[model samples]
Target: MQRRANVELRTAYNAFIESKRMSDPASGLTEIPALNQTLKPHQHDIVTWALRRGRAAVFAGTGLGKSFMQLEWARCVAEATDMPVLILAPLAVAAQTKREGEKFGIEVKHCREQSEVGDASIVVTNYDRLQKFDLEHFAGVVLDESSILKASDGKTRTAIIEAFKDYRFRLACTATPAPNDYMELGNHAEFLGVMTQEEMLAMFFIHDGGETQKWRLKGHAESEFWKWMCSWAVMLRKPSDLGYPNDGYDLPPLAIEQITVGVDHDRAQDTLFVMQAATLQDRIKERRETVEERCRAAVEIIARKPDTPWLVWCNLNSEAELMTKLIADAVEVRGSDKVEDKERKLLGFTDGQIRVMTTKPSVAGFGMNWQHCADMVFVGLNDSYEQLFQAIRRCWRFGQTKPVNVYLVAAETEGAVVANLHRKEADAERMAEQMVAHMQDITVATIRGTSRTKTEYNPSVEMTIPQFLEAA
Candidate 1:
């Protein structure tokens, strides 16, 4: 009788363990046709994995063929469902994506409104134009630079997630999903319907306490969280992270130089001696006070390479105006510019018509591929490390043949800002390493069509009832 009771207990325990395993159900195609032949091995595998998962994200680094993979995914989904797949991208990227589609032999239609999307297998539109179309018509949707979902206003972000909650297929592709904040991972998770943000927090995170917004992973939940992440998303800084060769995907040498302009101590009214900017307001003041010097430094850097293409990123309109005015061949793309004007100038720069382009990182940093230009200058910077990282990547990403040089021009009083940026960058690098370490094996297994095995419960010592209980 005791032996039989032990057997029943072990069975119940195994059943409980199986029920607690974390794996998303595959709502996607079990049998996929041949994908685009142009895909690299890594790209092909990722595309296949995404199609199998139905709703997924590809957090591939910049210049790692995200465009190719996403286009192929869209094409296959469109063909499989016999319905259009809509791709929403940042401003000026729709045209670029359309061109990419053409290169890969996929016909992509660029549309602005619902009527323009008629009968197109793959439709590409800017994020701002999302409301102009009907979401119910498409079988699949792709967010090219899906990080914008977090950067956008709350209402816009919610609208996007709510609109696509029921879509049969979805893909979110971006390089920096969570640059410094892991909490942002919840955005993509929530968007994919893998879990709600609150639910994810409850499962894997604990309140870090002082601030209401702060949360950290629970100590025991790290492995399980990443395991859950691998089920629905794949992240890698390079091909080798997923056990692939890094032959053509290797990036060129990147050189970063800081140019510090002298700040006028007389401009500081609060103290007898000018000190490092300690707060956001002080940093803004320092940047504004030294804009002229910073802009001149940027102008000097670009002047040395006058014949070469230069990408200049600034923060304030004042900096943009000054840099464009000081640099003879510079074209500025401002936030207030008309959409057509922004597209024209951006494409002009891409086509080599403009030798120097001045714009805010928020304006032109997200998705532009500026490999032709190996030099860039940041005349202004905010504390947002993600923006700074993306701005530099515009010129420093893969496929650029020459060594890339980045110049950050800041005033002496703004030392703290630069230091803060460096600190955040270090944090981001550490976080990425941790992410890759935890997800590498799992991602490789998932992409290569292997299943994860849960730990089985085995009874070593024979289970025997207590003497008192047995007697009772």
Candidate 2:
């Protein structure tokens, strides 16, 4: 009897698995035409893969021409469905994306409000103004830098997912999502209608008992989760990952230098002796007491190279003011600045008008392209690895002609934060490798048009009904 029961359970599980695989309607989505001659081979392959899937995410690294791929995807969707597509971008990125579309002869209209949205097939607007647009007017939506959805305040993220619940075609494009941060991917899944954050967590992850108390993939479910993710999204850090040439996609070398300044902290009052900070309050105290020292170190470094373009990242308002006053011709961008003024200062730095620009990573880190500048300084270090990584990649990305130099200026008491950052960097690198490896096979299969589909299965054995419940 036990043997018979086990057999029945196995058969039921197999049937369930096969049914779920067959239920995905993405396989039936319309396949758009081939891309234009202007697109690179890799770009063409990615655009084709996305169109076929209909709702997908592309996690290509910075400077890999994500803008072109997204623009081409929008163009094809508009042409096929005969309905316009809306692109939500960061502050100044809407203008930059518009310029890129013009180069490809694709007409994209930039609008501040829905009333400004004209007859163009493609319309670009910043994410902050998403509520102003009418959802029924567009057939598809493209989210540039979609990671912003995982922000502390979940209002925007929730709004986007609810607003576009019924949209047939959706595309999310961003640089590689951080592996340590699972909520980022959860946001994407929820936005794409694949699964809710809670559902994803319950399906493939277990609660980690560490201080962070984050969710990690179950050891047994790791492979299955990645395979399932590949069914809805594609992640590639470079062109070669999908079997295309990597020419011009290589990143420049990064040189990280640490500058430690002396700060007089009364150790006896805080602790028994000088030790690494293990609490949030301790880190805050260290940072607050040593702001002057850290600023001096940053100013001295910037003074050495006054003629070159420099990007200075700071944590406190005081640091920004000090850098601007101490460094010659340095412009400061604060959070309270008007939208127009902030955009002007950022573009000025990109165009070489502002020799030095000072601001926080949270303000200008995510979507800006500043590859022209190779030198940057971090006057203060926070525990947020994502912010730090984004801040550095702004200049270290592709198309950078010079080897990027990053100076991490910290007080002696802040060694704990710096060390923690280094550890996170190493962990993030390892996680990226694992993620790419798991997705490589699926990505290759999808791009090459070789992925297999579920076929109906028929059992060979003929079963008889049990005697306990005979037909009445």
Candidate 3:
């Protein structure tokens, strides 16, 4: 009897895992001829990447030419597949997207109803009208300002995701897809069919609190989750992240000034000491009590340069009304305004016809490009850092030649709101840095990763059996 020797053979477990990880699940969509010559180099690259992936999300920052990228993407898909592409935009953004398309010689039909969308190569409509059109008619869909899918009214979000589920090509474009909460990313994941929101939560996250749907990723799953995200999405704050030059995209200097008004403690509180707002109701009470003071302070700042273009952001309808009346040339757009009126006034402001425009960020903040205006005033504060950032960026984005001025007008007691906003801003900045740093190289790799061809294992070395094994 002799001892037997063991022989080892290696399997392609690493190769199989790598291949499956990097493989794109999309139906291979063919690239079309260059649809737009006017696209910046980075814009061209993004469009090309979307074309290859078939379904993707471009989480580009404000003023990074997301509109241009989206338009070109729609154009490419429409041309390549010879099927119409649908673009779902925020209110007034459809018109803006149409204009962006024209610059590149791509014709975009802005539609309010299905009848208005006839025979168009690229159809642009608001998200609210998602149910109006037949989803099967279009081969591709693009969601401009895609974060709107996370709106509290989950109906629209659910409709957009389910409506476009069968479409061969899909794109979700936005500046903030997951602004503060990671759960927001679930909407994108589900919309793109990369993974269902429930599956994503189950795999990467857990119920953070005992009684809330609030999800925090499992500590060990953070890296794996981000890597999974990059397989289907690309988030870049600037072109430089994708190895493109950022020469013309540089933002001008931003000058933010805080204007504090003395609160009449007797009115807001019975005691001598005015306490800071600690809750939403308290903040609302403070805002209601001091709308006049905040607006008046904002009005004074605007009056200094009466001829200059200014954007005033208010949180309450009352604030908008007071500011519009107090400022002789101001126009206010409220939530109750007719759709036509809202579009007209927003376009009017964009065209420089309106010297001063007053509106809540909820009404006009998401998509309009107001680079023509260099001055802005925040008449009050809201808890949403996204709204605050969007409102400021309406003026402070790229293409503004002058330094942008932002005035934050708040009452003394609203210090808590202002401080909270500042804290959120800092947190957002840090999150953005982390997101970019984590995604930049990985994003480049993801794009390049998908194009990789799997290397087949071919061993040139001849293997010999062990003498003991051969004897056996």
Per-prediction CA RMSD (Å): 3.5, 4.0, 5.5
Candidate 3 residue 253 C-alpha distance from true site, Å: 1.1
TM-score of each prediction: 0.90, 0.89, 0.88
Query: Which is superior by lDDT, 1 or 3?
Result: 1
Q: Residues 284-328, candidate 1, lDDT per residue (tens digit)? A: 988888889999888888889879999999999999999889887
How accurate locally is residue 443 in candidate 1, as Cα lDDT from 0 to 100?
A: 52
Runs of candidate 1 with Cα error greater than 4 angstroms are 1-23, 268-272, 416-418, 443-445, 448-472
1-472: candidate 2 lDDT, tens digit per residue: 7567757767876777567543335531455676878898878878888887777888888888899999999999988888899999877788778888999888999888889887889999988878889879999999998888875377778888998988888999988688778888888888887777897888789986786547889999887777777667777778776667899887888988889887665754766766655677887788887788899888889888879999999988888888888886999988788867877888888889999999998888888889889999999877789989999988988788899999999777666455677899999888777777766776455664624222224557655445452332
- Residue 81, model 2: Cα distance from true site in angstroms: 2.0
lDDT of 3 by residue, 1-472 (tens): 3322322322343445455442336553554475577778777767777788778889988888899888888877887888899998888888888888888788999998888878898999987788788887899999888878776477767877878887778899988765457767888878877777887788788785786866777999877777677667778888887777889988889888889898876764476688777778887898898988898999899988978999999988899899989988899988888888988999999998999999998888898898889999999878787878888878787778889999899888777455677788888787677666667766444563335212223446655555766577
Candidate achieving the largest lDDT:
1
Cα error, candidate 1, residue 304 (Å)? 0.8
Stretch of 10 with least lDDT, candidate 3: 1-10
Error of 2 at 88 (Å): 0.9
Q: Which pairs, if any, clash in model 3? A: none
**Which stretch of 10 consecutive residues in model 2 shows the poorest summed lDDT?**
448-457
lDDT of each: 0.86, 0.81, 0.79
